[model samples]
Target chain A: MERILFGDNQFFAVNHISDEKSRAQAIKFKDDSAIIKVLDDAMAAGINTFMCTTHDRIANICDVIRDNPKKYKDFKIYPCMPYAHKYANAVTELGIVGTLKQYVPGNFFGSLFKGGVAYINKDFISIMELLVDAEMKMFKGINTPVIFLQNVITDLLLGLGMNELLIAFAKHVESKYNAEAGFITMNLPKLLSVLEEGGIKNPIICASINKVNFRMSGGKELYEEVLKQGRCRVIAMQVLGGGAIPPKEALEYVANLPNVESILFGASSKQNIQNTVETIKYHDNQRVLVE
Target chain B: MLKVALIGAGKMGISHLSILGAHPDVEIVGVCDTSKIVSDVLEKYSGFSCYTDYLKMVDTTKPDAVFVAVPTKFHYKMVKDLLDRNIHVFSEKPFCLNPTESNELFLLAKKKGLVNQVGYHNKFVGTFQEVKKLVKEGFIGEPQHFLGEAYGPVVIKKKSETWRSDPNEGGGCLMDYASHVIDLINDILSPINSCKGAMLKSIYSKQVDDAVYALVGIESGTTGVISVNWSDETYRKMSTSVTIIGSKGKIVSDANELKVYFKSDEHPKGYSKGWNVKYVTDLTEEVNFYLRGEEYSSQIDYFVKAVQGEVPNTVNTFESAWKTDLSISIIKNNSK
Candidate 1:
C-alpha cells in the first residue's frame, strides 16, 4: 500500500451519500478519456498507486497504460477482486457456466468442462484461484503490487468464519502474482485477528478508520487499539467518512494513527485530489515533527 | 411460530412486511430501514419495533429469521451478519451481486443449518410452476430451445437515479430484470449450461444497462435466448414471457396466460395440445391479500414453511441461486 493511493470510486460513480452525485459522476466519466485525465492529474500530483476495482472499464485504462508504458511506468493498480456488480451482471447474461467460461482464463471450454466441474465439486480454493486470475487478467504486465479482496467478499467471509480462505488468498497472491494480498473490510479488528490466526503475519488490511466511525464496524476506539497492538499494516480508507468528516480533521486523525501506512481517497476534480494529497502530506509531516 | 424481522423498507421489503404482518404463523418482531419515514409508517401500521440500524434490530428483536430486501450490494454483508448470528435469511435475489459472495453465503447457510431462500418469486408463480411441471412431465418431449423476454415502461427517460441504476450496486436491466428471466429458465428448464452473444446497452443511465440480450444453452441440450428492456414503454405494463420449444410441443407463457402447442394430441389429459391457453389466475390458488402478485406472497409462504421445517428448502436456495448468479456473471463478462 502506498501513501495517498488514488481510488476508482470517482471513476465508477460510487457515491455513498447521494445518487445525484453518482449520476453526475457517471455522466462526467462516461468515457475512459475522462477517467484517464483524472488519473493523469493524480499522477502529475506525484501519486502513483491506483487502487481500483476490477471493473470492465479498468481494462481500458490498463490498455492505455500498457500502450504508453513509458508515461505510466510508475503507475500501479491495486486490483480488487469480485467486483460484485460486474460478476452479478455477467451471471445474469451469461449463466454461471457461461460466466465462468468467460472469466476463467485459458481454454474457455476446457475450464468450463473441467475447472467448472471442479469448482462445483467444492474445490473452492481452485475456484478462488481462478477468480483471482480472472480479475488480474486485465492488469497483465502492469504493476499491481497489491491485489485486494473487496469488502463485499472480505466482510462476508469474515462474518462466515471462513478466515482460512483469506490465508489461502494471501498465499496465492504471494506465490502466484507475487503481490501482497490486501483485505478490505468494515471490521478491521476482527479481520486482523483472523488473518493472524490463519498464519498471515502483518497482513495488509484496508479499512475505514475515521473520527466519526462512519463505516468502521467496531468503532474508532477498537480500531485504534488494534492498530496499536496488532501486527498488520493498515491502509486507512473512508477517512473522510464519505464526506461526513472534514478533510483536515479526518486526515489529521488518521495520519496520527499508529500503523496506518497509507491513505486511500477518490476525487473527481484535480483541485480536490490535490487538496487531499497535500492535506495528507502536511498532516504526515506535522506528525513526524511532533514525534 | 417463526419470529421474522425485515431489514429493508424498499418496495420488496414493504411487500414482505405486508405478508409477515398478516401471516398467522409469523410474529413480526422488528423492521430496520435507513429511511426514518418508511420505518415510522411501517412501525405505526404494523406495531413492530423499528430501527434505522440492522444490527440494533437484530440484537434487540432477536428474530429467528430475517428477510433481506436491501440493495444488491448490501446483500452479502447483511445476509452474512444474520447468518453468522445463526438466523435464517430470506434474501431478495441476485442472491448476491456476484457468484463469489453467493457461493460463500450458500456454503455458510448450509454449514449453519439455517434455511436460506433467494427472492426468485417466479419460481412460485403458478403458471411458471405449471410450466416446470409440464417440462418435467416431458410434455414438450425433449426440450430443445427456449426464450425469455421482459419488457417494461420503467427507465424510459433520463430520470433521477438510485442504486438500481448503478452498475456497482444494481446491475441495470441485466441484474434487475433479466435475472428473473434467467432464474425462471433455471426453474422451468435445465440449469443454463452456457451463455453467449450477450448485448448489454445503456439507454437511460450510463452505468446500468437498460436493455440486455443473451443466448444461453442449457444442460439438457436446450438452447435459449433472453431479451429484456426496462426502457421499452410500448407495453402498457411490465410484460414477461417465456417460450419453450421441444420436439413434440412448444409452451408459451406470459404474465397472464400459458399456451401449449403440441405437434399432435399427445399432451397431458387436460389438453388436446393443438393449442391451449390457460389464464394464470386459473392455475393460481386464490389468495386473501395478494398485493404485487401471488408469487410474492407464495414465495414468502414457501420460505416460512421451509423455516418451520414443514417443507424442504427447495425453491431458490442459495445452491440454486448460485447457478443463476454464475449465469448472470457469464452474460455480463461476455457482454464486455
Candidate 2:
C-alpha cells in the first residue's frame, strides 16, 4: 500500500461540504485531458496510487492512462466496485430492465446470464462476482493492486451480520482479479472483527480515521483499540475528517497510528498534491525519528 | 426482545432490516416483501421467516412493531392497517400523500398510545442535530431568516414511469427532496406556517416538478427561502443544507459539517465568538451498529428505545412528520 493514495472524488464532483465547489469540479473535470493532467501532477508529486470508484467516466480516464502506459508505468489504480450511484442514476433514466441490459457485462451476457440469474434469483455469491466483473471491466490491463468494496455495500453487509459475504468478496477478488480485496467501511472495529472471525487474516480495510473521529464508526477509542491490535492492514482515509481538521494536524494524527499504512486524499491542483505528499512525508519522518 | 416484522424489502427496507436484525432490543421474526426472488434470498441467507403477503406475515409473526418502507401510495393503507391492529408503526417519510389523512393517523396513534415514528433520518444527523441544539440554546439568537436548500440528481433525464416521477404517488422534488429540507427546517428553526411564490418547475419530468423554489413563512414570524432541485447532476448525491441568520450570529449546516458565526465574544456554548466549525463527528455519539451514516441507525435506535419506554415518543413522531406533509401540501398548492 502506498503511503499516499489519490482519490477520484474531485473528478466525479463529490464535494461533501460545498455544492459550489462540487459544481465547479463538475465543470473543471468535464474533459478527460483535465483528469489526465491531474493524475500526471500527482505522479510528478511522487504519489503513484489512485484510489477511485468504478464510475462510467472512469473508463475514459483509464483509456487515457492505458494509451500512455510508458508515462504511467509505476502508477497504480485501486478500483472500487459497485459504483452505487451509476446504477441509481441509470434506474432513474433508463428504468430497471434497461439499466440491467446496459450494465450486465454485455458481450458475456449470453454465456453467463443463466448462472447469473440463478445466483441472483435463488442464491447470492455469483451475483456479487458478476457485479464485480462488470465493474472491473473498465480497469483492464491497469495495475490494480487492490479492489475495494465501497462503504455503502460493505457497511450494509456488515450490519446484516453476514460475515460469509465479506469473506466471499475477499476470496472472489483474490481469485478472479489477482488483487487484494480492500473493504471500505465506516465501521472499522466491527468490520475488522468480522473479517478476522470469518478467517480472513490481515485483510486490507480502508476507513475514515481522523483526529476528530470523523466517520470513524464505533468512534475513536474503538478504532484505536482495533488499530493497536494490528490484526488488519488499515488505510486511513478522510484523514482531514472531511476537510474539518487542518492538514498538518490530520496527517500527524494518522502518521502516528499503529496500522495505518496508507493515507488517501483527493485534491484538484498540483500544489495541493505536492503539499499533501510533503506534509505526510514530514510527519512520517518525524514519527520514525521519535520511535 | 421486542419482536419486529418488516413490511417492505426495497432498498430502505433492507437497510432497516439489517439495522434491526443487529439491534439488541430487536428480534426480527418476519421479513415480508412482494418480490419472490428477494424473499427467497433473504429467507435462505438471513434465516428470517419470509412471506409474500405482509398481512399474513404480521398475523403469523405477531410482531410488537412493524416498519413500513413501501412506496408513498401504499403507506396510508398499510400503516393504517398496522395501527388498527394495535401495533407500533414506523413508516418511511413523506408520511402520507395527503396531509389531512396524515393528521388523522397522528391523532389515532396518539389515542392508541402507541410508540410511533416517521423515518425522517436527517433529524438524527449530528450536524443537523447540532444546528437544532444551537438554535434552541440561543447561540444564534432570534433567527430572523433562513435558507433551506436541498439538491440531488434523481431525474436528470426524461425516461421512466417509476413512482418517483408520479405526482399522485408523492413523487418529485417537492415530495422527495424538498420535504427533507422542510422537515429539518421545521424542527431546527420553526415550523413553516405558510408558503408564498412557490414555483414548481418541471425541468425533466412531465408529471412531476423536478425543482421547487419558494419563500416560506416560519412560525417564528420570519420568511425564509426553500430551494430544492432533483435535476442537479453536479451533486454526487442528495445534499441538504440550512442557513440560519439571526440577531446574534449565523449558522450554516449540512449533513457533514456545521459552521457558525457569532457577533459577540461571549463564547456561548464553549464556541468562539467569531467563527466555529464543527464536523458531524463532534456532535454524533457512538452507535452500537453503524451503516451508511450514524443517523440511519441512530434514528431507528431512537424509535426502538421509544418503543421500549426508555425514551419518550418525541422526535420525528407522527405529529411532526404530518407537519412536514402539510408543508409539502402548502408548497404544492401554492405552486399551482
Candidate 3:
C-alpha cells in the first residue's frame, strides 16, 4: 500500500491571507511561531511535508526548524515560489492607478499626473521587474526541492488573450528552473502538455477535484484522460469542493482517485486537523478501487 | 407485464413512450393527443395506436395503466376519469392546480387502491444520491445550513402564453421551474419541519415570477435556501447544488461536483502535486437502477407496479395532494 502523503498549503493564516504585508508579518512574527505550531502538529501525525509560498515565509519556517533541528530532523519542507514575472506585462500595465481607476473612473489620468512620476514608478511593470529580480536572487543556491504554484488557467485564458502564451510561459519556467526545482502546480491537461514539452523528466501537477468552472468534463472522463496520458505525476487537491463536501466523504472520494501521490487539505482549526488525521487513517485501512 | 396508454404526444410523453416501448415487461398500447398530426407522428414513431380523444382511446385500449403528460389543468379530469374506470394512473408534476384538487385525487386513488406516482426526476439523479451518502456519513459534520441556486432561460414562444406561463394553468416559474428544486430539497433533506419562502416577481412580469427564491428549515434545524430563475441566456443550465455547512466540516454539492474541505491535525504541504481523476461510478449504478425498474421509473412504472401488486402505491394520490398543497401554500404566502 502506497502511503497517503498529506499537507496543508498556507498554514499560518486563519483565512485566505493574500496581502504581502500581512503575510510577511505572519511568518516573521515571534520567529514564525504560528508556522512552527502547524508544522509540529503535522509532524506528530506522521505528516512531515511542508509547503509554503514566498522566500520570506520559507526562511522564517526554516529558522524555526533550525532552532530545534533535531526535533524536525525527519521532516521535509517544500517551498513554493510564485511565478509572477510570467504575467509581467498584464500585471505591470494595471498598477495602483489602474486599480484606482476601476473603482473611481473618469479622471484617473489627471490623478496619475498630479500624483507625479513616483506614481508611474509604482506601475505593474516596475513591480514585476523588482519581483523577478528578488525571485531570481532567492532561487540561486536554493538547493531545497521547491514546487512553483501558478494561477488559475481559466483566468489566464480569459484575461491573457491567448492560451499559447500561458503554455509558453510554463514551458519557459520548466526549462529554466527544472534543475533547481521539483515540479510545477497545474491541472491535468496542462500537466500532460507541459510533460510533452520535455524539459523536466518528472513535473508535479496539482489538480483540483472540486465544483469549479474549469472542470468542463465529467470526473470519470478527466480521470481516464490523465491515466491514459500517463505523463507527469499529480497531486490531487480540493477533493471536497473547498469545504463543500463533508470531510469523511471528501477524503474517501479523493482517496479513490487513480495515480494520486498526495492530497492537499486545508485545515483552518486544530480540531479539523485531528479529524483529517482520523479520516486518512480510515482511508488507509480501506481498499481503494482504482480502475 | 402491464399495458400502458400514454396521453399528450409531447417531448416528455414521447420519452416515456420510447422507454416503455423498449421495456420487455411493459407495452405502450396507445397514445392520445389534442393534435391529430402529433398523435399520428408519435404513433408512427413509437409503433403504437393513435387516438384523437383520450377517453375513447382508454376505453378501447383498456390499458392497465395510463400516463398523463398533458398540461396540469387537464391532469385532474384525466387522472380522475382514469381512476374511475379502475385503471391505474401516473401523472407529471404539478399534480393539479391546487392542493385540494390534488387531495381529492389522492382520496379517490386511496379508495380505489390505485398506484400513483409523480415525475420528480431529480430524486433519481446520481449526484444528489452521492451527496445524500456523504451527509449520512457525517462528512460535513452536523449539517447546519444549505444554499442552492438554479437558473436558465428556455425559449418560450411569444403570444402563445403556454400553460407554464399562466398561474391558473399551473404555469409559472415557481410551479414549472422551482418544482424540481422543491422535490430535490425534499429528497435530500428529509422531513422538512417548516418552510418559510418568498416568491419574487423578478424577471418575467406576466402571470408569475420568472425568478423564485425560497428558504426552508428542516426538522434537524438545518436551514436551506433555493433560488431559481428562467431568465439566464445560457443554454439549458440546470444546477441543483446543496451546500452543507456542518459543525466539523463543510460539503458542497455543486451539481455533479462534490467538494469537501476540512482542517487536519497534520501540516502536510508540497508542490509535487499531480492531477488524479476520480470517476463517480455510483451515477452509473443509479442510471441502471432507474432503467431496470428496481427503482421507480416515473409515474407510468409506478402505476404498472401498483396494478401488479408488486409494490404498494408508494406515490399515492395523497402524496401528490400534499406536495401541491405545500406548493400552493408557499405561493399564496408569498403573494400575501
Score every model by TM-score. 0.54, 0.92, 0.49
lDDT of 2 by residue, B211-323 (tens): 99999998878899999998987678888999999988999888877889999975465689788887676677768777767788998999999989999999999999999
Per candidate, chain B TM-score?
A: 0.97, 0.98, 0.81
Instruction: Please state what fraction of the native interface contacts candidate 3 reproduces.
Output: 0.00
Candidate 3's residue-wise lDDT over B275-313, tens digit each?
211223223231111221212344444455567888676
Candidates in order have lDDT scores of 0.80, 0.85, 0.55
Instruction: Tally clashes: model 3.
Output: 34
Arranged by DockQ with the best first, the candidates are 2, 3, 1
| Local accuracy of candidate 1 as per-residue lDDT tens digits, B311-332 | 9998899999998988889888
Compute fnat per model.
0.00, 0.49, 0.00
Off-target runs (Cα >4 Å) in candidate 2 are: A90-102, A107-120, A286-291, B139-141, B263-267, B272-276
Selected candidate, larger lDDT, 2 vs 3: 2
* Predicted candidate 2 versus true structure: per-residue lDDT over A1-291, tens digit per residue: 988899988998877655667779989999989998999899899889999998888999989889998988998999988888887677555554456557776544444455554445443577667778878889999999899999988888877666778888899999998999999988888788889898888999999899987777667998998899888898888888777788888888898899888889999999999988999899888888988
What fraction of the real A-B contacts shows up in model 2? 0.49
Writing each residue's lDDT as its tens digit, candidate 1 over A1-291 gives: 567899988777676544346558878998999999999999999899999998888999999999998999888999998787665444434444455666766764464365534334344566668788878899999998889999866765553345667788989999999999999977677778888888888999988778876555546677788889858888888888666667899888988888788889888999998998888889888888988
i-RMS for every candidate = 19.3, 3.1, 21.9
In the order shown, the candidates' DockQ scores are 0.01, 0.45, 0.01
